[model samples]
Target chain A: MTIKHGGNIYEVAKKYGISEGEIIDFSANINPLGIPNKLKATIISNIEALKNYPDPDYKDLVTAIAKYNNIDEDFVIPGNGATEIIFKIVEAIKPKKSLLLAPTFLEYERALKNVQSDVIYYLLNESNGFNIDKNDLLEKLEDDIDLVVLCNPNNPTGQIIEKDTLVEILIECKNKGISLMIDEAFIEFVDKEEEHSLIRCLADFDNLFIIRALTKFFAIPGLRIGYGLLSNKNIKKRIINKKEPWTINGFAAICGDVLFEDYEYIKKSKEFFRVERENMYSELKKLRGLKVFKPHANYIFFKVLEENIDLKDRLICRKILIRKCDNYVNLSNSFYRVAIKDKESNAELIKAIREVLYED
Target chain B: MTIKHGGNIYEVAKKYGISEGEIIDFSANINPLGIPNKLKATIISNIEALKNYPDPDYKDLVTAIAKYNNIDEDFVIPGNGATEIIFKIVEAIKPKKSLLLAPTFLEYERALKNVQSDVIYYLLNESNGFNIDKNDLLEKLEDDIDLVVLCNPNNPTGQIIEKDTLVEILIECKNKGISLMIDEAFIEFVDKEEEHSLIRCLADFDNLFIIRALTKFFAIPGLRIGYGLLSNKNIKKRIINKKEPWTINGFAAICGDVLFEDYEYIKKSKEFFRVERENMYSELKKLRGLKVFKPHANYIFFKVLEENIDLKDRLICRKILIRKCDNYVNLSNSFYRVAIKDKESNAELIKAIREVLYED
Candidate 1:
């Protein structure tokens, strides 16, 4: 009955009898530069919005999202978060059989299950550094698969599917009359995102569905804002028409307009991650009992090599929280994912890992 | 494919070329007091929570809600809003056949449709002030009906089902092995709510499911928080095991603790509605071209007497927004509903209606 994945800080805090505010968590991948000051001030000054029923049509937010992604406003359907969008799209399509990647986001499976769709997984091999090879995937995207889901810069691994590879898959799926949903939730954190994103192909590929979130990079997960982009007019209409009113809260609606266009926050975030992700990856790689993988996003995924220590338990004793990847399909107890945080916190995690691994 | 619902302020504002902030909206029912000052302060101070994911299990929020409602903590499941809970319950149970009140909240139909459930309605008679006849509804709950939904102090009509009627239905449903869900979302605005609410019946009836919302009563619809109370352990486990993590945000999580105990706001809101609902209802009753029903909640429902006039269009011209009831199953363009607002706003609505109805 335990359905929880990550970010259960209150449970972790209470079980350990520590204050939630005191725990330094790297369990969930979020923007390292905290909340944007401009967005914070906007939320505080416009606190009155909580009283109003959010616009059911969500016109302005949709317009803003459409403009940001260079898509038609009619093709955009914003949700409470990317999670809701995933569920809605799955419900609307009602695919007979769905194909998902192993060690992917859990919500995709949950969403498909809601529609009673039979699901099969394309296992990503750990030996290949967990990266998806396009030709291998396209071979599997036969006519029998009604839908295919691919997460860019995949979670728990921080591995990116190459741009040309994605285009090939999209073209093949289109030829086979299959729907392709690409979850680009962490794309903004990847260096040179334009090379890895499917936003450019959206105008040409009606079979593609791209989900983008303002939660992570904009640092407003508590506000719950995300949107989907597609070129298929009929599919977009079906999804939007079936949605519940006010799925995007008024605060989140306001956030989409302001944060999506907040270029200053964007610039600052990219610079911080570009420098910090590398620094954290390098520092962790120096440890004797750990293997740090090359990360393309804000989080680094690593595996413990030594047989004597329980890495997740040792880190928990030190009041450090990192995601244990055991729950992910094909991932074992030795795998862990940590968000690349500020210099001080990175130092703390490094020191704790060294102390736990080297202690005689 | 047009969805009949409210809370799309962004779309309406753009359609009419009006700034959303300028429109006096009555289309969606919400508390007039806006976000609590303390909650606002909490959100601003805890803005950094946006940098981290919300606690997946929502323990603190659930504990606070349990304390507020005087129930066991395990009996509740808090959600993004009441809508999220409603969808989850339907999916989990996968009811064989369901019963709904016609012209009630529209989301029930959409949720049922997602699961492909057979839906039948017990339409409320307008001649009877839209009241539910317990005897008639009981007879309709035949052998095949797995679930029955009741919106107490029902939306759009503002009609309250008697306490004894709910008790009789609850007993009947339990005896017949059927689950009954009573949505008390707007119950706080109704006088003698404790008498009509099934909140206390959870221990006695395993088939009872009560849905409550912090959105309307606390005036934080933008925060998106609500919960479900049920005594059935099996159903509870199913919902908990299938839901998306962190559906409720951090500020909303804290809000369950703050607003539930905010005695001042509760007192002020109750007092304001006690006086204002009566005045607004009386004024509408006096109108020359409308038949206004007695309102037990913070909203009044009415029918246009004159066939030549479009009340929704006229009200829109006066910069006032009211929900058109034509979207509801049994309702038509002749029906409309408006909220009981502050004294000044109430007067403004009354004056506009008089001019539109009686003026040459």
Candidate 2:
């Protein structure tokens, strides 16, 4: 069964008979910096872009993406969002047996299953900080596994694998003729993102497929533009042949032309997240009966120390929404995730958790 | 091979060293009325809609579509475009063998091919006016054919199937355990559309599936919003389960909130097309070497009488683009389709054709 995702403020608003504006949403890990001003200006000025069919080839968008990533245009495959990219890449590979991290982005498992791929899980241990251990995972890299999908700064945990370790796995997978698909959806939120990202390794490793999203970092989840990069021209050709035309809407198709060039916005957002993430983490740790984990991305994941507490429901009483991670594989009702929002919102979130835990 | 679709002024402009604004695009049959002003205002006002994830269920949008069509909301499944609906419905059915009109929408064949379905075409005869004869079609619905796909006011021909004939096909399909998928993308352009639409028959016939697009009618093809209507709850649930989330971007999602309410725009556009389609059809018949087919929609279909003329290339010399129908099955190099634009544009199109055929 597919677990309903969080960040559905619309559903909550309707259910509670309140306006969407009234609720504080920390469920989806979206950037607090909001959409870039330049992009908004671009969209309004070019509102007529929707007047005709989007360029099916999306030449300008592709060129921008290629330039942004410093990768060849041939390596990029744009999608409606990173979600569509996930499904498309899986469909392209058609793996028989795939390996994924437990409590990772749920979409990867869903995408794999859609292709009738059997999924194997490598459980991240709480005792070991929910971090992927190199040798431990390497042991699970049996000959039978055809594909390995990793979510960098993995969802619900916010822990990222070091570049060297990631490269080791990539090399091993290559030797075993296994394709490694890494989702960099939140890679931009992490400090020194390039060090953690394997996108630069694409030319060196034909087996590597990296998926990235403008949704989370740019905070335009509703606009829907993301892409996958791979050096394999053969698979890329096959994917283009099978994929639907113009899946990316007009606004999304042209966003790359302005978004990649927004250097000030990118730098400011990076610095803001760097400060807010640490502040939120420290504040959460001050509360009683809460085990807060160190977060690398813009969201923090932790477990409730107290038993029989209903932390999520309690926090929701204050109209703040956070993700309950129990639905993820190998996770329990004790685990929860919350976005690192703006400074004021983050403080309110910390205070709410404090009130829910100690005041009640 | 997938035929590259027309109306890509982007590709044509780049190749010809001309700006997109310089060319006259008639290859894509978009409404000359352009986008509704009310929807554009709504989008500009709610620019923040793109800041967060769109409603995963798209309740408001779905409600609007249901109310607009007078169909129960349960029967509606929204997609990025009518093209996406084509692919999704075919994927859900997974038919082993399907029947399609030879010169219908190319996407159906592509969608069918994606599912590894064996496609059999019923070649539309020129002598029959490219019309589907009830008896001729019924005979082709052998035991092996599980699906039948039709493009009403059939593409590149603009010939429509009457309600009585369509009902007969639907009933026969239901009796044979075959699903009849009809593309009503051009139905809105047809005179007295309700009389030809199968939407009313959806309640009575479980085998009936209908697709409609806001793209052509609203002239927002780049925004990409369309839907499928089916009485089958089981299939609807399955499609939703397998489908990716938020394929429709935010602007497309919210446009429905305002668009369906723009009754004046709808009425005016219908009247405009009514006058323009006829005017263009009558004017085209005056051309020296063109055999004009009576158009039931906003586009006219015709065949060049002259031999070895390269009509499409000749028109390109004047920067006037019309769909070259030769790429479509059963359509020869002589076949072409052109959209009916506003008065001045229509005259220029006819004048250009006259220049190509007679003046040259």
Candidate 3:
């Protein structure tokens, strides 16, 4: 089977000749609490919305997102997903030279390459828990660069840049006349999300752009809803001008207002992740021949110390799927990522990994 | 009220202080038959699919589209909408010079402008019932052009380019090394879809591309599913390489296979449009000061011969909405387009127009 960016249970299910429901998926970092009851009820009731075109401007959705983010409605640009926003920003910016982090979410590189933007990676040191070095990163934001992207509670490693350091980088980019795009797709899963998100910085920094998605936190990845925040009115105008109309379907369009207001689901999800992430992290740390990185989000990342283990393949035999991190730049076959799911599923994954590594 | 592309019942409802369902929508050209029962059942039954990420490759959806069109699976590139595919193709091609119809679907111009492609228009002759001249159009396909776009059974005018004429243009484009994109978004609404569609020619012509959507014939515009067909392997690969993953949501992904297989819905829809389109055309022509163009699709385009009639606004007072075509590049305020809804709605629209023009 071809290696793919994870959460591909369809492929795995076909390969194993089993139903998709049989596979315990830890490959995609989604809120394991699942879709909020309120949102689901709302969507089911409004199913007839599929008959008409979605509101091209997506006014109600944008208004709700802006209210939730505490930013001006004018600052918000909603998209099909955070991925769409990422590509649109690159297209709008058409940057000559952009800076990215190695082993980040793979979509950024794809988006940059689409616009023929020269990409330079700022390698995060594994010794520092795959964290960005503040001074070193600031030094690299020279006048020559047109764009700089940072993913908070970053993918694969589940590490984050310090708030002060991120602010400093944003200021440096502003000073150097470079556009700063901060992808906070996983920010909601992090504790104290307000402190880690640059959404507040949008009021002061015109060059700062932040992207957020309901797919991860709301557990509605299939719904495809995300928004970009920027105080730069010109960029916002350009995006609106250039964007295709009604990319968000009517069902997804109404989700922001309903999902953002589901405080019960939000509270329950945070609590679940808070407890499960810690339990899974500690359990995995107990295993031999594994070096688990402390995770800040819903997923844990680790490197295998033993040779020729083939953990992903072995786990698949037990009807478990975990992300193999080899495809990620600067990460090798020995590295892997797994989502912290429900307690029972997490325990099953732990048992499967133990059987593969220690027993045989 | 700001002039917008029609079918925006949200804005209209707000402006009139009325519920959306109260207004009869004629602005958007959707099937009068409404959403297929099979598709609705499939979507509702699989609502839990929203818990997982959509397959990034959208293999099932693409395969279904290919099988339905009798084309190669590799030739299909599914997107959020026909609109998204339009933007992606334009971005990928980066055409130096492109040709389009003056009063075509508005999104093509927006897509072309996004890539800074020089747009040249072939104005349909108003004197000839807004139809394209075959010989004249062929003469305009010069070697300097990089891309050519055709909207079959053209929007607003409801006219189709002859199949033979279209084939000649395709051969001409191939000889000139110009890429041809035929948008068949409304083709399923046409009486003879098999003859009108260019899907069969894709295997032979590398330069030929066609865009299709379930939004129209399937009556699921709010669902947002569309696919592009092209035999050009390089172009398809480039699009896949550049495209952001999971543009099609999971619910929309499963739709292609189910919806395309709904032959009962397909037969009912075609029969409905065939009868209603003709009935409405004859009814519209009976009006004293209206010139109704012969329609090939599910909508009728006509001109109000009298000046200062304000047909759209006057009908709006009667709680009916019709597309005022002044926003189209070469269309004027006197021109209007209306969907061929069910018999009752069609009668009400005809009655409203007669009342507005004759009584007032």
Tens digits of lDDT, candidate 1, A1-360: 255556667778898987888888888687868788888888888888788767666777888988887777867888878987898788778899999999888889888986789999899888888988677888898798889999998987899998888988989999999999999999999999989999988889888989888888887777788888888888878886666666667777776667877899899899999998888888999997998879999899999988656787788888998888888888888888998878899899999999988883
TM-score quality measure for candidate 2: 0.99
Per residue, candidate 2 scores C-alpha lDDT tens digits across B1-360 of 145777788888888887899889999999888888897898889999998888888888899999999889988988999988999999999999999998988889998988999999999999988998999998998878989999898987999999999989888898899999999999998999999999999888877889999988888998899999999877787788788988888888888868888999999999998888888888999887999888999888999999778888888779888888988999888999999988998999999999989989
Residue-level lDDT tens digits of model 1 in B1-360: 267566555666777888877778787777777778888888878777776677777778989989988999989999888988888888777887999998798888887886788999999998888998778898998978999999988988999998888999999998898899888999999887788888888998989988898888887887788899998999998898777666787688777777888899999999889988988888888897999988988788999988778887787777788888888989878999887777888899889989998884
> Candidate 3: deviation at residue B132, Å?
1.4
| Residue range A253-335, candidate 3, lDDT tens digits | 88887899998888888888888889899999999879999999999999988869889888887888999998988887999
Any runs in candidate 2 off by more than 4 Å, and if so which?
A: none
Candidate 1 vs candidate 2: which has greater lDDT?
A: 2
Residue pairs clashing, model 2: none
lDDT of 2 by residue, A1-360 (tens): 134787888887787776889899999889998989999999899988888888998888889999999989988988899998899889989999999999799888888988999999999999888999999999899988999999998998999999999999999999999999999999999999988999999999989999999999999998999999999987788788788888988888888978999999999999999888888888888886889889999999999988698777887778898898888999889999999899999889888888888788
Evaluating just chain A, the predictions reach TM-scores of 0.97, 0.98, 0.98
Q: For model 3, what is the error of residue A32's alpha carbon versus the real structure, in angstroms, after optimal superposition?
A: 1.2
Give the per-residue lDDT digits (tens) of candidate 3, residues B188-275: 9898888988888999999998998889999999999998998888888778787788888989988888999999999988988888
Of 1 and 3, which scores higher on TM-score?
Answer: 3
